[model samples]
Target: MSMTLFCYLMMYCSGIVSLCLARKHIMLSLLSLEFIILSLFCIFSIIVTIMISESYMMLMFLTFSVCEGVVGLSILVMMIRSHGNDHLSSINLFLC
Candidate 1:
């Protein structure tokens, strides 16, 4: 694999590991999820470039990722407003 591809894969793996291990805070998990999304975007871009295909799909993918980020941030804001912090353990579905 190329160096760039290897770097992206490593980034993806690290994001997964961080997401799994850093469960104390919602913000950490969100950041890890974003990292994973970015790595996926990079990999997808590389594939599309290699194939010399149209870039409309990449634009769509970017749009979806941005939407996902907005939703996640909104949720985080709501959580902080309600609970006063971003701790995952502090979130109780029964209380909601």
Candidate 2:
């Protein structure tokens, strides 16, 4: 594999590890998730470039990733406003 591909794969793996290990802050988890998405986007773009294919799919993926980021930030903001903090453990989903 190319060095660039290896780097991206390493980034993706690191993001997964961080996401799994981060059990305290919701923000940390979100950041890890974003990192994973970014790595995937980079890999996808590289593949598209190598294949000389149309970049519309990459553009669409980017648009969806941006939307996902906005939604995640809004959720984080809402959680902070309602709970006074963004701690993952503080969120009690069982509470009705």
Candidate 3:
């Protein structure tokens, strides 16, 4: 693998590990997830660039990541408003 690809792999792996370790902390988990997404985006962009001359794949991935981030933020806001906390355990999955 190239140096850039190796760097991306390391970043992606560390992000995944951080995400797993930060499961209990909502903010930390979200940041780690974003890190993972960014690394994946970079890797995909490079691959797409090499594979095709006309590629919208990177744009599509960027949009998807933005949407995902918005959704996650909305959920966090709702959870904080309703539960008065941002911890995963504080969220009640089923409430009637």
Question: What is the C-alpha lDDT profile of model 2 across 1-96, one tens digit per residue?
Answer: 499999999999999999999969989999999999999999999999999679999999999999999999999999999999999778889995
Tens-digit lDDT track of model 3 for 1-96: 489998998999999999989998688888998999999998997788788876787888899999999988888888789889888887676974
Residues forming the 10-long window of minimal summed lDDT in candidate 1: 87-96
Number of the top TM-score candidate: 2
> What tens-digit string does per-residue lDDT give for candidate 1 at 1-96?
499999999999999999999899888989999999999999999999999679999999999999999999999999899889998878778965
Total clashes for model 1? 0
Rank ordering of all candidates by lDDT, starting from the highest:
2, 1, 3
Q: TM-score of each candidate? A: 0.93, 0.93, 0.91
lDDT of each: 0.94, 0.94, 0.88
Segments in model 2 whose C-alpha atoms lie over 4 Å from true places: none
Least accurate 10 contiguous residues by lDDT in model 3: 87-96
Candidate 2 overall lDDT versus native: 0.94
Residue 91 of model 1 has an lDDT of 74
- On TM-score, the stronger of 2 and 3 is 2
Candidate 3 error regions (>4 Å):
94-96
* TM-score-better candidate, 1 vs 2: 2
